[model samples]
Each structure stands twice: as structure tokens, then as C-alpha cells.
Target chain A: MRAKTSAALNRSELEEELRAIGRRRYHDRHPFHELLHNGQLGRGQVQAWALNRFYYQRSIPKKDAALISRADSAELRRVWRQRLADHDGDEPGHGGIARWLNLCAAVGLERRKVESLDGLLPATRFAVDAYVHFVREKSLLEAVASSLTELFAPDIIADRMRGMLAHYDFVSNEAMAYFDRRLTEAPRDVDFALEWVLERAETVEQQESVLDALRFKCDVLWAQLDALYHAYVDPGHIPPGAFAPQDESTDRPRRYR
Target chain B: MRAKTSAALNRSELEEELRAIGRRRYHDRHPFHELLHNGQLGRGQVQAWALNRFYYQRSIPKKDAALISRADSAELRRVWRQRLADHDGDEPGHGGIARWLNLCAAVGLERRKVESLDGLLPATRFAVDAYVHFVREKSLLEAVASSLTELFAPDIIADRMRGMLAHYDFVSNEAMAYFDRRLTEAPRDVDFALEWVLERAETVEQQESVLDALRFKCDVLWAQLDALYHAYVDPGHIPPGAFAPQDESTDRPRRYR
Candidate 1:
């Protein structure tokens, strides 16, 4: 069992402790992450990563919608509604899912192929589904606390966006438009979420549950990278009956350059 | 998508295909499994595997109950109810779960600690929960088919029981009473389940779904092994917070000769 720090932390100290949890456990610390941010991964690996990650992105709004539906106050729901809008977008071909689709397209994955999730690892699906279930079933505070991983995301996104553009020839400014938007959006959302947690988690048990929720969310993110790293990055150990990179078509030129 | 065989297979062919699925995808093929059956793993690694696996064993009746609740026919429910009986038993401390607790006790794990599942891997929890959810939400045919892994369990149990007794001096005949029962119980259970699938999966799609359910069950079993391998077998690759072997205790002598 982890040692319990006294529940006497002031609001700022508690916030720092929560942010520290993110610093230590977030997916940005994972190895595949370094490969991704540094643009050291091959095109097919990137495509595989994006395709699998699309499952996570697509489920976010559904989880958030579940959170919204459970909220008693219209004001809380109104604040939560922005998350739905951000992911679902005003119309088709726009929101986070669409932006993720664009990343897949930029990496040369066919739209239909990406949409079908035909090639994703089973572990990836299980991990993402587990997250959706966690939010739907757990206390609302824990659900919101799970989203607090976003508090750490803006910095990682900055580092990743800069590193990818600087190191990779194939990546373009347009390819990473999703990260650009996330930089602004994540902090605003996370700020609200963090405050909601600090207010609701008055008891030590509630605070610990919120902390555990963040830890669980970190595991969800880290597990995805572990699957990708195991399957794509390290000698490409694809699990049985998951996506495989298509053979280069002889009809197409080897190099666009 | 896999090629669909014609819906009209003779009963023998259906059974063969089902057995073939087990041959290809069962946890016996997992690397940690080989270490287990070959006596290559250390005692701590062995203890960790047994501890995590208890979660799967404990969940079996609940998954079976979900299937029993969904069955419409008294005869079908009668067949499935046997599973509940087999696991839960007529009296306390007399069923499969109690048998599993005995196995854990033999491994030097405390009964309360094992039952608390405090030492379990997060992946183990998610994978088993996913199996329960799959049985509850999927078609009843798929739910019944998922238990079809029992068809292959008798052989694996034979191999595991023999290997553990031969390899580990700490394990005794009394400790492994769980397998003696499973060796008989599994075949009886599998025989009924195989007949159930053969009788019910009348369409190609239904057959395919049944096949897929077995595959999913295989993945669930395999994923638990994967978590064990990654955390215990692999050097320094433990997930953020999972079971850790206690530092070699000076007070207690090593159990193995």
C-alpha cells in the first residue's frame, strides 16, 4: 500500500501533488512516446499508432456525454458540453475525431481502413473500453478527475509538435493541427476539472480516489503505448489477427520526391 | 474477415474447428506459460502468476451466471446451472473458488490477501471484467461459446499440475488438489458446452461469432500471461503499480530445496 500523505495539504499543495502524479505516470514518459515525439518512427508505425489511438479519441465524447447526462446542474452540464462540442464538432469532418482522421490520412492510411478499426490490437480496444466503463460507473468526481491527465498534456503536446516538425520530413504543419488546438483547449478544460476535484474531494478518501482515478487514466494511456510499442516499435510483434502494414503497391512510385 | 466455412458442418467438424482454435490460441502457447510448464521461472514469479490467475478463476461462475440468466430453456439452463454448482458448490469452502484458495495457500499466499485481490495486476482486472461484460452484452450463443475454452483446459491442467509438482519443491500434492478436481470437472463441462455450440450456432455468422468469442476468451487468458511476463519475467518492465515480490526476507528460509 502507498503511504498516505496527511490530508492537511492546502489547495495549492494538493494541486501540486495531483500535477506531480501526472508528471511521474503520464504516457509522455513512455518509450513509444519518445519515438513519436522525436519523429524516429517509420510511416507505417505512425499510421498504426494513429489508427489505434482513434479508438480512444472517438470514445471521449461518449464518456463525457455520460458524465454530462449524470450531472445535476445545468451549469455543470453547460461547462461539460464544451468537451462534447470539441470532440464531436459543430458538423461532420471537423472535431477531434476528424482531426485524428486527418493525421491518419497524412500518414497515408486509407480513410475506410482507419474508420473500420479492423487492424487495432485487441488489448488497445480492451483498455479503451475499460476507460469508458470506469467513467460510466464510478463517482462523478473520479470521472472528472480522470480527465485531469489533460493538465499535463499541453506541455507534452508542445514538445511533441515541435520535435515532430523539426525532425520528420514527412510531417507538416497541417498534419499536426490537432495538437495546436489541444494546447489551448486542454488547459481550459483541465483547469475546470482540477478545481471541481479540489472542491468535491474534501475527505481524504475522496482525494485518494481522485488521485487513483488519475493514476487509472494514466494506465489507460500508458497501456495503449505499451501495445503500440510491443506491436509496432519493437521488431513489430503484431498480435494475432490485428492490422498489418499493407505491402507497397508496385503501381505507385516508391518516393514522391 | 476470415473465410466462412459453409454453415452445415457435421458435428465432428464443428468440434474439430473449436478444438483447433484452442490449439492455436490458448494460453499454453504464451511465453510465461512455457516458463511455467518448463520449470524455468523462479518461485516468486510462480507465486505472482498464481495470485493473479485466481481473479480469473473467481470470475468464472459470475460469467456462467450471466449465461444461465440469459438462457430461455429449462434444459439449457439446467446444463449451464451445473457450472454455477461446480464453481459455487453446495456448501461453503467446498467448490472451485475454495479449491483455488487452496492453490493460493499452497503457493504461500495468504487467503485474505488473495481474496482481496490487492496483489492483482490492473490488466488482469480489466481483461476479466471485459469477459464478464462480453458474456452479459453479447448474444447468448457467443456467451456460451466463450466458455468453450474449458474444452482445452483438462490437458493444460494435466501439464501444469505435473510441471509444478515436478519443478517446485515448495509445492506438494496437497497444495494442488484444485487441478485434480478441474481435470475431471473441465471435460464434463466442456462436453456439454461443445454440444451446446454445435446445436445452436446454425448460421455461418453465428458460427463465426462463436469462433470469435473463443478467440476473445483466448486473448483474455493470454493477456493475463502477457501482464505476468511483462511485469515479472521481463527485467524492470513492471507497470506503474502492480504486485511486487517482497525483498528476500532474512527471517524465512527459502522453501525450495
Candidate 2:
């Protein structure tokens, strides 16, 4: 367990503590990610993942906007403005959410169904919404700290893109554009967020809150997978009204059928 | 799927729609509940349920208070005030939360661990926080409608009480005082809430929102059970830091041991 002590630490020590949290609790360590990164998950299981994960993708811009709204100065908000544009784009039919939709479509989920969020797991909605609310309600330092999950995201995105390309015959390099985009975008965002959090969290209490925020954010990402693993993976009992892929019983990709 | 139509119906039709939502979507129909109410769960599994559920039990008054804070009238606030008293009591250590802690204690969990929320599943925290946020942020009618899950609560509580007492020697009637109190309290609370919803949801949009609110509330309850079932039941992969039972490998009651 991470110590809950109130004793203050040096800047480098605090940064190490934050990095340690990502090492231990990031969603990349989750079993679902393990299966997802490798070829272990079936085609329908992959579709289930894409379908539910669209909720998180869709919420990113909204959360970024909330964080921008809470930012203290034009400098912070100006730095954060790239995230909104990065996810939302300069015009319609663009950006991260749309790219995610493309990935969902590539996986054989209907475009309309994915856009409508017709069969999202309730747990996904709750977790994503909680993250947005955390940014909106918590201190600005904590809000920036929460985005520190991005510190770990680029590595996972690389692993995911590499694994999916190699393992899934149906998945093409073009279809993995979202991860490719995030690979660059995430590092840029995290660098600013990490520096801001480290510079601003000067006191023991603020530092602990920063650590807790990242831990909370990690929990948010981790819980999303736990829901997926539970509902669509082992002993799979899809909750009433969640997406239930038709080809779950088969190992083959039945996208066209 | 529940229809999202805007065509207004008569009061009875609206009431029927709301009741139908409960019939189809309430957590009672969740498989985890089926296992628990049928006396199929092991003692450690039961402890997992109680430990995670303590979060939900602990949040009721906070949600109720949020609802009360939003009430437009003394009359409405006055009616909702009983929920606060019922869950929190006239004095410390006297009401529903206290009774739930008693139930947790009787289930062989240490009091400090449960109170500290040491091993809470992130999904549980997310789902419960979503419910509370719904009450705090949504329309008053929708908030009250969310509580309409109470319309179906009595039966489940009775089933839970009987099943736990019959199947688990570690459980006793006193351990279930929480449910017994809720049995009477829920009906009275729901009567007012149901009537308020029926009387106030005068427009088609309002009625539809009310129905959606109940559906949202059911999703909250069902998602909590999904987390429990995922973590403590079949192919269980307890999330890192979540409560893990020591005797999960055995079916025998090992509370004393």
C-alpha cells in the first residue's frame, strides 16, 4: 500500500512517487489489456471492447473542456486548449472521437449504434462521468494531476497498436489510427500536465491530493476494464441492455456477416 | 428496449411505464442477487457483498440530503427529512448506516476496514457516486424518480433476509436489521415518491425523463452487483487493492477460522 503519510517529500521524490503509482495501478497492467494487446480475445470480444470504450473516447473532449473551464489563467487554458481541438478537431467528421468511431466501424460495430451509445455498460458511464466530475469539482492541481495517467498512455498505445496489427488479421494499420494519434498527442499533453502538477503541488497536503488524484484517475481507467472483463470476458454475463456481440461463440472474425 | 417517445400518456400509463422499468431492470433480477437469495454464495462471497455494499448503504443519506437541498418547498423537504433520520438516526450510531455496519460486523469483517473503505471496488464507488450525482444534478422529478427503485426494494430485502439467515450460520436476524427497517421504510417512501412523480410529470418529456431516471437508477444498482459478481464470483479477478477473501477456495463457512 502507498503510504498515506502527511510528511512532505522533495520534488524529485514526489515525482518518483507519482511514477510509482502509474507503474502499479495503470490500466495497462489490467488483465483485459493483457488479453486485448495480445491475440487472446476473440473477434466479438474485441468488438465488445471497442463498443464500450467509445464512451470513454466520447467523454474525453467534455472532460478536457471541464478542466479548461477550471483552469486559473489564460496560460493554463491556452495550453489545455489543444486537447479539446485534438479530440474534437477544427471541423465536423474529424478528431479522436470520430477516429475511435472509425475503429469501432472497422471492428464491425454499426456506426449509428456506437454513436448513439445504445448498449454501453453502466459501469463505463459511471466511471467516465466520475472522472469528468472530478475535474470539474476538485482543485485545479488535482485535476491536472488526474491527467497524469497520460504519462503512462503513450507506452500502452504503442503496445496496443503493435499487438493489434500483428495479431488480428482483420485489423489494418489504417484502422489503428486512433492509437497512432494518441501516441504523439498523449505525450505532449502529459508533459505540460506533469510539470504543472509538480510545480504547483508545493505542500504535503497538496502533494498527497495530487497523488490521490492520479490514483483516482488510474482507478477510473482500471474500473472501465474491470467492467469489460466481467461483462464480456470470463464467465461472461452481459448485463441487461449492454452490447452482446453475435460472434462471441466463435474464434473467427465475422465482421462481414 | 424502452421507448424514448415524446407522446404523453395518462397518469396510469405513466405509472405503468415506470413500474415496468423496475420489473425489467431492477437489481433483484441481477444474477448475483439470484445467487445470494438462493443461498448459493459462500461466506467469503457474502462478506465481499456486504463490504462493497457498505458504500451504497453509506451514501443513501447523502443523496437524500442532496435531494432535500434541491426541494422547492418546506412540504417536500419535510417529507424527505424522514429519509435522513431513518438512515442517519436522531443521534450518532442509531440508524440505517449504523445497522448496516452491524450487518458488516456480523459478516466477520473488521469494523475499521469496512469503515475505512479499504478495499472498495472502483466500480462500486463510481456507480454509487453516479447515483448521488444524479440526485444532486438532475431535475427534482428525475431525482425523486431515481429513488423509485424503492418501489421494488421490499421484496428483495425480504428475500435477502430469509436467504442469508437460512443459508449462513454466521448470519442472524440482528445482522439483517437494516433490511427489516428498510422493508417498512421503503414502502412509505416510495408511496410518496410514486405519487409525486405521477402527479407532477404532466408533460410527455417530463414523463419520459422520469422513466429514464428510474432506468438510470436501476443501472446504478445492477452495476454494483455486476462488480461484486465479477470480483467475487465466476472467474473472479479481484481488482488490485479490492477486498479478496482468504477462503475463496473453500465453500465451507470459515468466519471463525
Best by lDDT: 2
* Poorest stretch of ten by lDDT in candidate 2 chain A: A248-257
Q: Score chain B of each candidate by TM-score.
A: 0.92, 0.94
> What DockQ class does candidate 1 belong to?
acceptable
True-structure lDDT of candidate 2: 0.88
- lDDT per residue for candidate 2 within A1-257, as digits (tens), equals 44666577888988999999999999999999999889898778898899888999899888889988887799999989999998898898799988888998888889998988888999999999999999999999998999998888888999999999999886888789998999888998888888888888888889989998999999999999988888878768787778777754574433321
> lDDT tens digits, residues A153-188, model 1?
988999999998887776789989888999999999
Candidate 1 pairs with clashing backbones: A119-A243
**Candidate 1: lDDT of B219?**
84
Q: What's the CA error at residue B3 for candidate 2, in Å?
A: 4.6
- Model 2 lDDT per residue over B1-257, tens place: 44557468899998888888888999989889889988888778898999999999899999999999999899899999999999999998899999999999998999999999998999999999999999999999999999998988988989888888888888999999999999999999999999999999998789888988999999999999988887888667777778877674674433321
Please compute DockQ, using alpha carbons, for every candidate against the native two-chain complex.
0.39, 0.81
Task: Report, for every candidate in turn, its global Cα lDDT versus the true structure.
Answer: 0.82, 0.88
